[model samples]
Target: MNPPKRPGRRAVCLLVLFSVWWVAVATVGFSAETVSSEPQVKAAFLINFAKYADWPSNAFEKANSPIVLGVMGDNKVSEELQKVIAGRVINGREIVLKRANSIDEAGACHILFISNAEQQHTPTVLDQVKGHVLTVGESPEFLEKGGVINLVRKDQKIALEVNLTAADKAQIKISSKLLSVATLVKGKAN
Candidate 1:
């Protein structure tokens, strides 16, 4: 078998810098388009975020409780997430994808992906998952609505807006590495 390839110094440096830039430009002037690959990219982000975040000891019911990722709408993003996370394990916990149409149904999840269809119910959903779930959304007003993470599209590229305040209120601890690549914000959810 061939030896595994490692990232070079230049590659590592670029990654670090890219993380910072990705978050910084989330709100800059950019037009939105129906990017065909958006779902795949977002699914990857959702998984990677779990790898870089630390959940509280009590977040799970047991030592082996799977990390439940809840989807709250019917869309390509949910389907893509299911495909990407199938049979994957993070930190020894198997990943589970659950689809829900209501707040109560999604209450037990560790991570909740709010679909555009549910954007109107953002506030109610946030209230339901408060102090527990890591909420993610793609709407421009998601952060203002108290979402933990908002994915913004800029020039066809996805950028992240991380609300540190919201995460703190939910008692979720995000990794410094992940924060380094996201635009940090603080405010009450509207």
Candidate 2:
């Protein structure tokens, strides 16, 4: 049997930096009411999340299928994500972005980012993608509604809340490294 490869010094350093940043965001609440939009930063986080999540073998259509990131509503975030993912690859799969308008469209995506514009239809979206996709949203309500991850703006910085129950139901495995930095929660959005 082969032994697991340990992380290199550089990887450990990066992990430490990420952990510190997450701790700062989680512990020290942002105090500012209004700050500049951070779509680019959010987009970066989304990409990194893909690297830290494990999907079922059937999630992709084929061995060489690309990881499809579907954006439903919020053109700005979609555009930002598209720009960041351009030519990027995760787990040997190229990253692709798609604008989705319906549940069926979103079901084909590996990661579905539901924007505030689609807030009203969150339930339907979640139902459609349940057990097959990683659903991300920007509101606490999303976590309540069975979303796997919620990106919230605290004060001015971004914070994460993960729904482990939802992820387990969907058969997705979120890395321990990612969970170490996120505030874990569980429930259906009311």
Candidate 3:
């Protein structure tokens, strides 16, 4: 008789990430597209992270204010996110996608995404938005630059690297479920 089999570690990890990704996508009604680049995936993660993180009341100007994603120095991610966020509301607030060219512009958002294109200005931007924004980045040195959550590539797939110190400083409370799937870091840097 053949033995019963369980899922492998890699399969289980993929399943968890995929399930979170799917639920996030479903919440925003993200349309299925033939994504051609990493930007799209990062956009998805940005939305997913936004759903999982909680910010202070001051992050929003009003109770009905939008949850804004201020994407810095990358139009592709911004554009793809616009599609996913179009007319979507979460926790009774609308989702707004925007592009930012400077730290000042990025500071006004609930969620800030710093692209590799803006790597040189990451420190300044991270400093500007500290204690309020849910910061996400695609660069390897993002968490080191004082960002909260950084997306990384592992085994040819995208994974999450979370800096709890940064998140705590930013006052963004990330769900334990989200943290369970991430590579957690401590004490400001990885």
lDDT of 1 by residue, 90-129 (tens): 9999988888677776778888899788878888888766
Residue 112 lDDT in model 1? 89
**CA lDDT of each prediction against the hidden true structure:** 0.81, 0.83, 0.81
* Model 3, CA-based lDDT: 0.81
lDDT of 2 by residue, 1-190 (tens): 2333666766777787899999878666552442436787788887888898899998888987998888999988888886778889888999899988888888888888998888989888887664468899987689888899999988678888899988888788999999998999977732
* Among all candidates shown, the one with the greatest lDDT: 2
Give lDDT: candidate 1, residue 8.
75
| Residues 1-190, model 3: lDDT tens digits | 2333556766777787899999988866744556346778887888877778998888788999888888888888888897788877788888888787766677778888888888888887777664478888888878887888888999878899889888888778999999999998663531
Q: Which window of ten consecutive residues has the lowest lDDT sum in model 3?
A: 1-10
Clashes per model (N, Cα, C within 3 A): 1, 3, 0
Off by over 4 Å in 2: 1-36
